[model samples]
Target: MDSRVVNKGQLPELLDKLARDHTLIAPVREEENVTLFKKVSGASEVQLDYITSDVSPKGCIFPQTEKTISYTYTGDTLEMKEQDEPPKTVLFGVRPCDINSILALDPVFEGKFLDTYYLEKRKNTVIIGLSCSTILSTCFCTAFNSGPCDGKGADLMFTELGDKYYVEVNTEKGSSLVEAYSQYFSKGDTDKLAKAKEEQAKKLEGQFRRKVDLEGVKQVLDENFELPYWDKVFKKCLGCGICTYVCPTCHCFDIFDYVTGEFTGDRFRCWDSCMFPDFTLMAGGHNPRPSRKERVRNRFMHKLKYHLDRYNLDGCVGCGRCISKCPVNIDITQIIKDLKEVGQNA
Candidate 1:
């Protein structure tokens, strides 16, 4: 709950210090128009000029594939070993929408049934959020009341203002980092800089091309299990599962064991998707979501209604990864607008 400023010129030094002290996960541009969050080798590997990474950095916590338990069988006895503790990590350069998505995932993994694997990594990681200087045509985080510079869930948030970066220390973890690197920071007129950050957020907010309204959409979804609207929507769906795969908030996963030897095996969980036809296939050879229409309906309903019903949080963070990456151009913002229409007519 304190503020400081760091010169943009000394950013590399700060990054280098973080890399030396902690496991740094930051965005790196791999090729033309391709950016991803990768384990940083040093400050030179971190890319700061991108609008958004191609994929959300959720893997840092909930990896796409993770070993949960390894077991050894001997006669009538069995022994199992759980995963080791995660390292002290720094998740840097995360955006507001992606940060919110992590919050949505927090309750899913920590409440009632505890996922120690996800929880341990989440606890050990310090999130450094970055303010967006620009907006994309598909970006709609504002619809969920999350703006470009919103920093509700970040440990530390950075807003670029001309010559220096306005740093908001949001938690003790972030404060510790700032304290450790006190030489790189100065207690500038943060109140005025805070106002400048607000003005920057406001200007970027107006630039978002997609305007989404969730007003009565959830109510409609709650009342109806089946919709003719889904029939038309599912037509172009290829059942490729790309939307669910790239989503920051989608948490569906499948667990299986890999046998390394006759008496040993490792149980692992990997990301799964509702868009896949075989996702809900029962071993008895019947699938509840048997077709593209039903699968597509479930995907949208889960994003719009099911998650809200269960967690009281918006499942989709409006990061627009699905919109940008969908091969057939299936857009969730348009779906929300159409669903709002359906609710109105109902």
Candidate 2:
């Protein structure tokens, strides 16, 4: 757990070095109100002051659309080709909640059935997490025992401590990268800077305006699978799927083939959402989740109970992108609070 200090002025040079060595992905402001994680060449392309990107950087690992294999068949001959290996990558400026989301996803891709597509990118990438300095109205990471500065799953964590960046090397991958670029880091006793980061985390915790409690909410969802609560929430849902798209933990996808010619095609996988009606449709055209009520119930149930039941980890990380992006103002925190109230009444 060695820590080092780097002047804010040297960040550009550090980014330049990393970009030259690996594929660099960081947050960049596309417009006044929009910030998205994109491939960057240096610090000039990175938005270092953003609270959160509009979209999670999860796409870097499990892409929205990916070609799994290409195939061609002519007469009696057939040929198939798999995709290339992912390049060495540096995922920079990830928030702690997003880091937690990646951990939540790890089991889904790594258990009895391993997803090599995701595993390859994960194996070749180095995660450089950034500590959150400010709190948004929707943020409630504290409810999950995660804070703005928690670096639980990161290889390296960078906290902006006034004029300098306090870098904590948490893994061998991080240590090797730091050792390789020793010129950017300054030798120092990082105790004072680490303390400052803690103080910053505490201050930001109190600044959170939302109080999200999950004490008995999961139990309620587990007991009452068919509730009048589904009727209330689903009425307002537009089935837009924005929540799943912005969510860091939602990982449903569909696979099919795209025909290129008479004897050629490529098999691809793309993101799918349980919020959509077709998500549960069978090949016979019978949909288990036939209405918005069932779909909406399933979505929240998956978040509150199912994922935790399967993975022993909280499915929702309280990042609040779903809350902020929902056109009808459907909030997961509000849902948890309401569910707790429902449980108390029952």
Judge candidate 1 against the unseen true structure and give its global Cα lDDT, from 0 to 1. Answer: 0.93
lDDT of 1 by residue, 219-326 (tens): 999998888999999999999988988899999999999999999999999999999888999999999989999999998999999989999999999999999999
TM-score of each: 0.98, 0.98
What are the runs in model 1 whose C-alpha is more than 4 Å off?
none
Clashing residue pairs in candidate 2, if any? none
lDDT of each: 0.93, 0.93
Per-residue lDDT of candidate 2, residues 78-170 (tens digit): 899988999999999999999999999999999899999999999999999999988998898888879999988999999998889999999
- In candidate 2, stretches whose alpha carbon ends up further than 4 angstroms from where it belongs are none
